[model samples]
Target: MRKFWQKNRKTSLAFLVAALLIAILWFFFWPLNRVVEAPGEAVNIQPMVKIQGKQPLKQNEFMITAVSIAPARPVSYVHRLFDPHIDIQKTNDVTGGQNNADFNNVQKVYMQSAINNAITVGFQHANRPVTKQYHGVYILNVFPQSDFKNRLRPADLIESINGQQLTKSTEYVNYIKSLPKNAPLKIMFKRDGRQMMVSGHKHDIVKGFNGIGITMIDDMTIKTDPKAHIDPGQIGGPSGGLMFALQVYSQLTQQRYQLKKIAGTGTITSDGQVGEIGGVDKKIIAAHKSGAQVFFCPYVKPTKTNLALEPGHQTNYQVAKATAKKYAPGMKVVPVTSFDQALNYLKTHQ
Candidate 1:
């Protein structure tokens, strides 16, 4: 028995080493199903995006704010569980598709979002008549387990869904909302500049509701003023839309004034509507820290809030207002549903 034990010692040692390596990989290196988010710093937009060609009048700096979010690993997720400010979300929830976390692809989408917001806001706020020429809808991210999984790519353009051409994101959403459950849907998309067609079963997304699981936005050309350019450097996302428009308007129309330094976040369209954005609480803290005198946040009624919960749930104005009081007592957090409202407030206040 002693001779047998000695003979197998090396084998047992090898097995133990292998098991340890597996445990270490699982604990530290393997990807988990969750991600962590903490309060990000508020970034000033005045210098990040540059407006070229035709410099209007001069005024005090009007800044925009962004929350600094960092993705966490599984080990960090456990630590975040005890942190009140840190948020945990599924990896799929944040990335959508299996490969959505490809830093380059994500950066492309973010830059595109920022560009769209900058252009649309610039044209609209400049009081220039803007025309939207829609080509298709740009696929931002395909949700995990989606029917289009393994078929559609991130940059694919969905030209039409179910034989209906899409010009706006609202149209695609409304059309999907009107579809019958379990119906087969046809999607015509352009990949690598080539058109392709595919059919898929719909997904029962969110409490028995049937629709395609994808995140996308309209691909439209905003033709109004080509001379106005907004360079957002590497910063991405649509959250800076409102602030971009405000700053662009100040430059385009030459409405130079010594207005108080302002900070805002929202998705702005070519029609002058200010859509809601995420991270209002963190953004308010950022704005206050940046010494912004006014913060323009989106306003959505309770009814609207309930409808777009997944896109975003919290009422930005309410959260921003509350956060401002706690973090920045002297700052004014204003609610705005449209650019008109913000402009009016600026007129009155400035």
Candidate 2:
């Protein structure tokens, strides 16, 4: 009987050991279905652009930062859920497909578009002529929560709003903004090879962005400027448009002007309009880490997450404003709706 009892005890111990080993392997090696986003490094934008027949002012450093996201292991995903600074989304929601290379190529294409628009807008702000033609505003993206998500899509050309001719993006924006909240807008657009009219009421897509919820660029021509040139090597995306325009504007207008180190992110339209961007939370942290004295953020639009997540005044500026206070109390966060507003702020504040 004693021998039999000892044998049973050893058998139970072996089973426990095998179970422990299996649990350990699963804990560290299992793949997750989500992607995580966190702060990415910040970079200076002044060095990115090269002007022809002119030396850009070296007085200030203009920078833009990005957020990095990646697929997570089971353990990492579970851990990130509790981290306030880390953001997560379903892989499908973020990547859309398994082909990362294709997505990167798309980003490069968008970056080139940003550079083109920035060059035109920056030169225009400097009062340098580069033939501005009003063809129609181009939609770059349509978020799922936007009121226009069902009616409009990316690459759609905006021809008119409420029977009024749409020239610049600002015209369309002002017309919609002039109405009360959730007002219906009559929009004329061309998609694919056909012209279509869509009527939709703008909702609180974001708390402050009560108009159409589409990211846009101009569909007009921007003849390259003779006096200045921009060469942004390897770096890709529309977020740097605002800073690129500022760099060009500051260099051309001011002679021997010293600038305080400022960083920002936004898109620039051909007419010197500033548009909103993603990753405002991560960017604020990166700019502060890079020792930026002041950070300029877009005040153009807002998101449903920003509106619902943040109760009051939800815009890119509001996110940057809150981020600056929380992460870098020493850094000043300023918001701008146009290139001139950003320029004037720098001139007066310093």
Best by TM-score: 1
Which tens-of-lDDT digit does each residue in 1-350 have in candidate 1? 98899879978999999999988777766665666666565555555444556554446566766655455555776666675456677766665535544534555665566556666666666657656677777777776557987687776888888899978778888898788787789999987789999999887766766778888877766556545455666566677777777776766666655455777888776567888877787777777777778888998886764656734455777777777777689988899988778778887875
Off by over 4 Å in 2: 1-30, 78-83, 96-102, 131-222, 227-234, 254-259, 300-313
Q: Write the per-residue lDDT of candidate 2 for residues 214-291, one digit (tens) a residue.
A: 766656556655555556676667888888888877766653334557888888776778888778988898888898
lDDT of each: 0.71, 0.75
Candidate 1, run of 10 with poorest lDDT: 95-104
The positional error of residue 200 in candidate 1, measured at the CA in angstroms, is: 4.0
- lDDT value for model 1: 0.71
TM-score of each: 0.71, 0.65
Candidate 2, position 268, lDDT: 79
Alpha-carbon RMSD to native, per candidate? 5.9, 7.8
Off by over 4 Å in 1: 1-33, 47-52, 56-58, 73-85, 102-114, 141-146, 159-188, 192-197, 201-215, 303-314
